[model samples]
Target: MKPSKLLITLLALGVFASLAFGQRRNQIEFYGGAAFPLAPETFKDYTKVGLSGNAQYVLFPSPRLGITFNVGYEAFSTDDEKFTDALSTEFTGQTASYWVGQGFGLSPSATVKSNLLRIGAGVRPYLTDPEANTQFFLLGQVNFNLIKNDFSAKEIPYQYDAVNDQLFFLTFNDEEY
Candidate 1:
């Protein structure tokens, strides 16, 4: 058979199979777990621990195959920014600047933090809850990754000479990014 014809035949077969296995109802689930940062530089090593939570709603409009929609959230922060700040501060020529523009002085820098959100779809063979009002169902699911409350970049560094020997700045202890 021609390639296009064969592709159409396969798609029709899939739809037929789904109708043959159709269940009557739908199911939804709510759950939360821990999130691990998979990216190396995006999140701090092991420091990006966070919470994962989502709601999955399944639509078993037919039988064998159902569609799932998942909406989820994951919160995280990385260690690279913290490490970078520390390394920069340790450099010999780098001085801490007291004010925003003051630099090459005893300027304190902070790390960057981030929150992520996730969203996706999935399929399951069987899903049911006899006790629920609905009956005969398949499970559909989705996963979502969302990034909320993104942190701002640290202040840019500038140069200062001995003409401005005095450096006085006030920073709040609770400030974090």
Candidate 2:
């Protein structure tokens, strides 16, 4: 089975178990933390640190077991890089020759930004008694994430060949996807 489906099944089971045999205590909590990329090499030139925040509402049917509903957001740092490439034109119907301009004059650069929204359910089990001043718990959660990416590119100097009526530089101008 898919990982997401398996996670949902476990969360549902936890919720149902808590509802069947647990006392009623409702609580709300807010959390924030830094997220580290598990596979930083996959991202190439991007930063590895991300910021994350979440809010959760818990319903306890028993002193030890609780069902939680959570909503969260995460933002990854932006990364920028420069690339160099050449554009060429081909001539036909007469003497055919390719005109190529290769140099650092066309400095192209790009920036990438990523963000995510998360919604999920989980089970939290308290290790200590409910009356303790400090409470500790083991938590398991299943989250569905919506991801957004913004990619933009630009050329330092736009170049055009009027004789061939061709624009040598092209860019998306800070578009989000």
Residues 1-177 of candidate 2: C-alpha lDDT, one tens digit per residue: 999999999999998878765555688999999966564353434645799999999988788888899999988875453221211111111110121233334445556677789999999999999888999999999999887767666652245566976545556655633
Instruction: Write model 1 residue lDDT over 18-77, tens digit each, in one string.
Output: 775454557788999998767654344425677878788777655545677788877665
lDDT of each: 0.56, 0.67
For each candidate, give its TM-score against the true structure.
0.50, 0.63
List ranges where model 1 is wrong by over 4 Å: 1-23, 44-47, 62-64, 77-107, 127-149, 153-177
Model 2 Cα shift for residue 22 (angstroms): 9.7
lDDT of 1: 0.56
Q: How close is candidate 1 to the true structure, as a TM-score?
A: 0.50
